[model samples]
Target: MEKALVYINYPELIPLNDKSTEYDGYITIDDKFTYRIKLQVPNFPDVKNITYSGGRFHYIAIQEEDKLFKLAYYDIPKISSELLKEYASLNELFTTYCNCIEELQTYFDVMDSIDTVCWVIDPPKPKKSDYMRRIMIGHNVSIQITFDPLNILNLPQIQFMGSENGVAPFRESFINNLDNWDPEYDVVQNILRLIDLPFFPQEPTDAAKSNDLDFKVNECCICFCVQLENKLPDEICKNPNCEQCFHTDCLYQWLSAVGTSRQNFNLIQGECPNCKTCISCRIPNI
Candidate 1:
């Protein structure tokens, strides 16, 4: 199964590929407040911001051999899937794999990973602003990555906006192109190491602190108290079995932050934290 994501053009996410600061074929660069917009997304569809998906909310069902992946938000208590007829397309599989997102959220809850709320953005593939790297490392929490702004359109509030203002009023209103996900050379380095991805092998000059495993993690292991440097998580471990922790501020300190990609980000052989013993865990905030 290919571990990938989906990107869609929803009512909230308009086709403002124009006026791009960065040029990539078919990928209109919308970096506008990608930072702030990314943050607001998890909060819900704001009249002032674009809509987004957050939390460890996902559901899956198989019909006629085709797997149907659904997005379920405890926040909205909404269960959604776009007639996901089958689960073969990498896009579908990945999106449906997001069905496991609920499982991921469950995993985080039991394991005490990520403490903060996470905005699950599902994109078909990596984009200029896409940072699976951070979500991979940041501890205890829900994670669903998608670019299908349509997911937001289904949000109760977004639906309201669409009916009242014809949807165009709120399209990408909060996410300016400048906010697109761009990691500096150094920031990428830290994110790669934090995820413990094999994509990049270069270690940090001072790798010891970033690898610290002594602090008392009364909170979620995936949780990072401080705000992310590039809105990417370096603190906490993404894998269930790994006891290692990293820093969010030092994303640029590790190695080449680019090109270190993997199919499955499992580091502990499908075991939970307390690697010494397999402990079934789930996140608390979800």
Candidate 2:
């Protein structure tokens, strides 16, 4: 007898292509296992500014026959099928993937390789799709790539926002455009090395540093401690106009004190204490 494929039990995530109008309220897949890989380019410059560069973040869901997994923060340029076939087990596959990411990291001074978080998102209880969506389990990191040789000043400005507010056709196109999985072809190291980055990143000058301090006052919302440029912030409110930032450790303690346990995507979803704007806390591995 064939083994049963575990379903996510989240209807919203059901692929648009499925024909059934009334979903069983379960995310059934032909494949028993799947992978949701999230790549975040958190530090790209504004497109409206002289530096016209648009970074991409991708969420790839790969269907397999045995397990459900999620990986975060990467930009893969190529993948090879042979090595992937050679390493069929999860442990070997993960090791190979990390090796590729490490190789890619070596090519750029600023790009860093981080540990990929892995966990099984257990199936939700009946009528509890909302509950499942609220819980997240995994490591999160800021995936970055540098354009050291690209002359931002010379490029024409392109008015482009981001996928955070994704519309229909564009979102569909992006999902359809992801390259097919091949472990060997996905070596970004070789691709990035051949192409020169647009601009070499530099440390903030004294004048710029002074201006940043003057404008923001370098203060954290929770502890009132000075937030340096190099320090980690726990939460930054998603509101475009809001500028409130907080230390993760400080905010976590504050949230616990306040008894706000509401969470979404494994993050503490609540309003910023400073600006009253909503924020989601995904505490990094500090």
Candidate 3:
């Protein structure tokens, strides 16, 4: 099969009518057009043969114009499943994977945190270990975190360990440093905090309902996981008739399941899960 072509130069037919309008990157030729220059696939080292269910974590090399740019590892089960379902080849999968990460970068500000994005560890392969994949210098020690796709379900499953270097620092701290670190604690809280999640689950308190009118705000309309003390809702529907609230993550997942359409930043527009009221919903801006 002819690999997807990225026209790096303007075609002869479309002469430089306006030099000022020229762009720096590749110029895509339309389906009716054709070009000769084709990008060659950069050589990537083979991943160690390992067995796992769903999908395997991988350190992928990203290249452009035959130039090696960077390496990254991610829990790509969901993305891989999408690729397999689409019947994409290895090259197509790599390209699509890069494009997906780049697109996600624009959608979530949480991607800004390198500590939250990825964790680096020495793997079984020594020849491939040249530099840290992602890092930050702090307290005279460089703290790093590996980016994991939080789509997994359990705590132990989500805690990604390095092949040879053991676990990253953030996971270590959450386990050893944080006194309240429990399996019950939300796994996505660290990711949420980076995005400045607007509301937290409100804590439910004793005393009668008449004791404090603020008590009603404790329950999430979708999943009534209320607790004692103070917590907050991540987002509330703007619909006047349906003031139903939900955890932003919860709502986002629900929206993806039911929504027929999607907008920028991973937001979905469709009927409300509870009231069946059509609405455009997303994570709060702040």
Candidate 4:
């Protein structure tokens, strides 16, 4: 009869079984923020018996949950001391839980905005408390942004990745437009404004895929392979007419076998395999 009354008053919470010891529901605050929650209440009146089984807890970092739980269970002295009559009601406990979750509104807001706009490359999926993300911004280009969880509306620390030539323009634009960043906008919006892009690049289309397959410019002339040991043929012959490509290791080994090859510090001065033109290979650091 008591469990039936509690369900009638708090329709948001649904019991898992006839015993009504477990519940699955959501807590909505001010009709704006809602978080899914699961609760196990073996001893209803004893707050300690109420165990949080799942929901937004998974969205947040494990380390930060302790503080939230403490806030929910112990922040109110009367509730913790068992002196308040309202503590006997599950509604009162859920209200306190909702208040604690409200404090994390900014974190949830920022994460939702990021998910809507960015293609997160690293950590593929992010927690509500994850402050860093690497997102694809352009073709073969990405930018790593470390957000300030407290000041999410402000500019984040950003590092651009890809070839030097590819990322230089974006880097330059970001530096020049730093003052133009508007804190009123979301993180992704501010970043797009700074880089002057309408939106982040999506995955390549079928036409782009076909174009990429049309060339084997990255293939190694020595090993006759496109990639070996996860490395492309990065070493190229200086001769414009005989611009053959070789992996750094392959070139170094070939040059070392020739008696004419001379080692000067970390450089191997050698002849091109095709043109016999003077070329050099920088001995890659092991």
Judge candidate 2 against the unseen true structure and give its global Cα lDDT, from 0 to 1.
Answer: 0.33
For model 4, the superposed segments whose C-alpha errors exceed 4 Å read: 1-14, 19-21, 25-36, 40-100, 204-286
Please state the error at residue 239 of candidate 4 in Å: 17
Could you say which candidate leads in TM-score?
Answer: 4
Candidate 3 to truth, TM: 0.25
lDDT of each: 0.27, 0.33, 0.36, 0.62
Kindly state the number of residue pairs that clash in model 3.
15
Sum up the clashes in candidate 1.
Answer: 52
Q: Residue by residue across 160-268, what tens digits does model 4's lDDT show?
A: 7543455678999998999988888766778987887898765445577556532223457788885677565656665656667787888888899999999999999
For model 2, what is the error of residue 195's alpha carbon versus the real structure, in angstroms, after optimal superposition? 14
How much is 158 displaced in model 4, in angstroms?
A: 0.9
Per-candidate TM equals 0.18, 0.31, 0.25, 0.49
- Among these predictions, the greatest lDDT belongs to 4
lDDT of 2 by residue, 35-57 (tens): 23221122221001011011322
Tell me the alpha-carbon RMSD of every candidate.
22.2, 21.4, 21.0, 11.5
Query: lDDT for model 4, on a 0 to 1 scale?
Result: 0.62
- In candidate 3, position 252 carries an lDDT of 66
Encode model 3's per-residue lDDT on 1-286: one tens digit a residue: 1122212222322322342221122222333222222222323322211112112222442223232222233333233444332212333444455444433432122322322333221221212112222221121122233333332212222222111122244445545544443444443454323323333323234555446543243346667753212233435555556656665656666777763756677566777777777655565443
